[model samples]
Target: MTLVRVSRGVRMHREAEPDLAAHVRPLTRISGSCAASHDTAARLWNFPEPERRPFDRRIHISRPSGGARMQRPGVVGHRSRLLPDEVAYVDGLCVTTRTRTWLDLAEALEIDDLVVIADYLLRIPRPEFEGRAEPYATREELLAMLRRHPGKRGLLKAREALALARLGADSPPETRLRLAMLSAGLPEPEVNKPIRNDDGDTLHAPDLSLPEYRIAIEYEGESHGNADQIVRDIEREERARAADWDEVRISKRHMANGARRAVEKIAVALRARGWRQEDAA
Candidate 1:
């Protein structure tokens, strides 16, 4: 039997073969063929749990000589047309496209898992095969799918993906906070808006702000407690104080108790800033 080298010690014949044990051994790990559809596809597709074994299924490989078939006894072959750029050679097997990865993930994922997978896929940098894949659709079609399914897990995933793709590397925390606030029936604050001083110099851009009430709500995550961040926070507070803006900071702890107390605190601050209590209510 002639063997062609693919990876460090992996080999495959120039022609197809029936048993691919040697080729399958190294490629069965997490980062290897498991990431692609093959056996993993069954899991993603919600197939019945199979009894634990050494390998999942055998895959078929083609051989060059006529009538000489080599069947890999325990590997399942994932058949899909891949774009030239999407095809990645990892460990001796071809890695599937991100779109294919997501599709497989969607097939077996529960609602929440599906949403997360969709969100993660959308957030990936320059995701290849998005519009070029088999289920071809224009960007509008994709957006329409999201709009049609608003408040659904699929829509949440689509929205998250769109935001990540468009915003580059910005954290999604602010967006999530805003969504949670809105869902709780609070008026949406202007996002990432700058608070300026009398001299027109920008003081700080609060994550959320109410211009009329001179109120700001800042979401303080763990990063805020760092030494550099503490200094910046002091400066921001001083600027806000000079500008007569009442700043309210909310942490994950505050949010954990629900937005009632946070909302009430903001409402009181707004009232003190000459905003009508009724208007705030």
Candidate 2:
């Protein structure tokens, strides 16, 4: 077996690329004080960043304020006064809790990006698919975290993000679309609200909907480009048509220029469905 050196005193088979856990676990084990934090913890919790980037080579480790600073070749060390509950063990590796990770991210990301992550954390999880019934974190819990760390680096950004964050946004794009519409002076749409037929059977759960105007907005991400998903999307559009709902389908192209194009598409659909510009005001 060919062994590749990953970190000091740590080696792995060269055939397999080291995953986040593989890279961080050893670094955390270097001392009881160290825990995975910042971008590293966000990745572990599956928070969606504004833009995708290659996995950073350096591991982010945090120790208590008085702990000795880590001097390692591949580690970015931080010193903060962490509450006992702020850090937890995930899959045997020490890491900051989900809410703390978001606070850490607020320092590095824009307000929109922070809102995207906040939405991700607050979205209800599908127990059947996600293996858990509860959201990753809640608004109150996040607020409490903010209160605890009044002097934290990104307190203002985190608070702003929390104010904009809402439940039911399933993806970053969905959250961005909602934010864009708000920015364009459109009426706020319900997130992932189910539209049902007269008999009360659920027909479609649109990404965003204005039930009063029968407008359904769907943000189709990259997955929707697949042949199989395209067929399903067509069928979904037909259902909206049959139900007399104006369905606005948005794609990556529509997300250009701060999602101005997406807002325009949705605005047109809303107008056609009897929404008026003055109504939004």
TM-score of each: 0.47, 0.88
Highest lDDT scorer: 2
Error of 2 at 79 (Å): 0.9
Candidate 2 — worst ten consecutive residues by lDDT sum? 49-58
Give the per-residue lDDT of model 1 (tens digit) for 172-264: 444444545555555567766788877888887787888777788887889999999999998888789889888988776655444555666
Query: Which ten-residue region of model 1 has the weakest summed lDDT?
Result: 60-69
Off by over 4 Å in 2: 1-17, 52-57, 197-202, 225-231, 274-281
Against the hidden true structure, what lDDT does model 2 obtain?
0.87
Query: All models: lDDT?
Result: 0.50, 0.87
99-147: candidate 2 lDDT, tens digit per residue: 9988987777788888988999899999999899998899999999999
Evaluate residue 270 in candidate 1 and report its C-alpha lDDT on the 0 to 100 scale: 65
